[model samples]
Target: MDTIASLFSFITTPVSWIIVQFHKLYGAIFGPDTGWAWGLSIVSLVVVIRICLIPLFVKQIKSMRNMQALQPKMKAIQERYKNDRQRQSEEMMKLYKDTGTNPLSSCLPILAQSPFFFALYHVLSKIASGDTIGVLNQELVNSAREAHIFGAPIAAKFMDSEEKVAALSASLTDVRVVTAIMIVLMSASQFYTQRQLMQKNVDLTVKTPYMQQQKMLMYIFPLIFAVTGINFPVGVLVYWLTTNVWTMGQQMYVINQNPTPGSKAQDNYLQRLLKSVSSHGEVRGRRRRSVVQAIVAKGADRNDNERKFFAGLAKAGFAAQADGTVIKSDTVTADAEAGSAARRQQPKRQSKAQRQSGGTHQTGEAKPSLEKQQDTPPKPAGKSSPATPRQAKSGQRKGSQRPKHPSSKK
Candidate 1:
């Protein structure tokens, strides 16, 4: 009975079965010593999984856009009922109801991938630990154990996670450089994958506070992957790194063909990062100068002022683009307008909805005469005051002034 159950379990374990096939495939295709196959297999698997997650990723992006769109109305509700928590809750609910957006939709893809990520980790760990005999058939185990993919033991640094390596591995062999490179690439690529997804695929509208929150999460999430990448297996690292490269390519295709409103199709993080890295500290300084110049350019030809200001920076070899503003591209238009001296001098324009709401609340739109005030007569300027004892003593005059009534409007 135990043997039968074990056979059924063995048949179901995809990783174990795949590991068996990998050994045979490598042996048959490229001979016994050509060990690059394992890495390629891992990369292929990662790509397959990422492709499968595409729908989820698309859904996440759509939901996130909806969330961003709802943010302005939610903020208005928050402000309108700032002191009344109950009404604020009601208003918030109404806003969400109208917008059909949920704040949590942003995390759907990540949540869906959690189990697969853990499963992959476990599968890779098992193979790398040299305990494949039970997980895979004996023939497959023997063949796999002899395999040296990338000149390192397939199972060499499975749980090591660190490049420093264990004393046991050092006594047996040295693959620190390979393991370290793998780990770094894995971490860096994961960072790039997440960063690109957010900066490209996500239809993030920054007009709302919710979108800013998403932006903060984007950086925070990448930072997390960079920190946690150290703990994943090197094979897992390769998987991650490859998956990221795939995502970058996939997202690039999507963005290039159908870019988001605020995104630039012609440029990418690689260009910016490479420029920043190559220029030492000069890129950032130039960026600040260019922004200041662009702002100045909107009003005056501050070229002379900029020259004196940025003369010390000429040695840095990075200068503000001469026509980045003057030439006018979509990227530069918003920056030139808002960051400009002209915009600072000009008052902001109010929206039509705001004007209508303000008029309804405070203008003559709701004007009506007060019936009570209209009905009450003022004391005659030349007549004696009614409350005086002398005037009261003239009872006929006081009695005559007090009697009047009308039918209720209700």
Candidate 2:
């Protein structure tokens, strides 16, 4: 328990302290009596956290995109040494090294957030429940209990209370209701943020497996949030909703400014939104696939096959050499380096006859006796071959060149 408390202290020590300070400052500005002040503080905390996380979020997203981009290459590597497990493991790591994409990037931000969440839980539990939380002196605990956002007391919102739902009345189920609503908002924001990323914000160069993973997240997080939200205090839900909303707006800003090329956000999400609001309100597909398919169909009309293919490759850097060596490319192989390259320019296999013929024959040589034997007619049964006459006459030549077989040594 002491170890757990010490671990708890690490996250709560700074962030929760800052948050408690924010509540104080907000209450100071709004007057200490109003619950709206606490509301504003939660909102404020969300904004600050979002801003602080922006760089990390960018790093996470960039890592995911790179992972997506390298998927085909990874697959190609897998296929190449399918029969060789040890080599496959080696090559897979090499492929990851080459791409600088860690699959774990998709999870790092999540893991980093865990401590902050636990700390916030402890802090809010104390504030709402008046638990005194060991770290907070009695004065601080009393002040937190009195804290309000706007005119509503934070303690009244059920989020801060740290009590079970059964303790609250049917009349006060509103607290649970509010909690549920906030939970939905949290899940919904997470859902749409992910949806937009797949349907809009991704780099076109993103690989299929990565895209599939993103698609999986669209469903996964919502379910997770829905199940988990009921257990969290209402204050925590507010924080979650706040955090998610901040992400939503920040992501929208990024799509508008540095939108990924060949992504739906660049091509449609922003454009469609802008258009719907524009005098030229030309709304396109409600779904991203439709929008992309439409674009591909239209683009195909103007682009010749080779030009279009190269353009696609150029954008993806598929045909471009990353490692300073020129690629003789094949479309079938999944990896850029290891794919169907060998097949594309495979040297034709030599027949057994050609292999047996020691090296290529140069013109203008007299046939050797072995060559003559092959060509020679069979002598009548009683007679020795007259062609033996050549070897007999020039025994030294044949003997010096190749002895048919030496005696086997013991």
Pick by lDDT: which candidate is best?
2
Each candidate: RMSD? 19.0, 16.3
TM-score of each model, paired residue for residue: 0.51, 0.57
lDDT of each: 0.54, 0.60
lDDT of 1 by residue, 1-410 (tens): 22323434433366445544564565567764345666656655665567788898788667755664465576677777889999988877777777777777767766765555555566554455545534565445444445554555555553354443442233223445566677666556656665765666544443444656666776676567666665565555666667657756766666654434234432342244334533564334454345445534654443233344333233333334454322213444444556676767875565787575553433336434454447766778899775644445633654235434666452
How does model 1 fare in lDDT?
Answer: 0.54
Clashing pairs for predicted structure model 1, backbone only: none
Model 2, span 338-371: residue lDDT tens: 5457668876676675556544334424345565
* Clashes within 3 Å, all models in order: 0, 15
Error of 1 at 206 (Å): 3.5
- Displacement of residue 11 (Cα, Å) in model 2 is 2.5
* Candidate 1 segments whose C-alpha is farther than 4 A from its true place: 1-12, 18-27, 32-34, 78-94, 133-135, 158-174, 194-209, 262-410
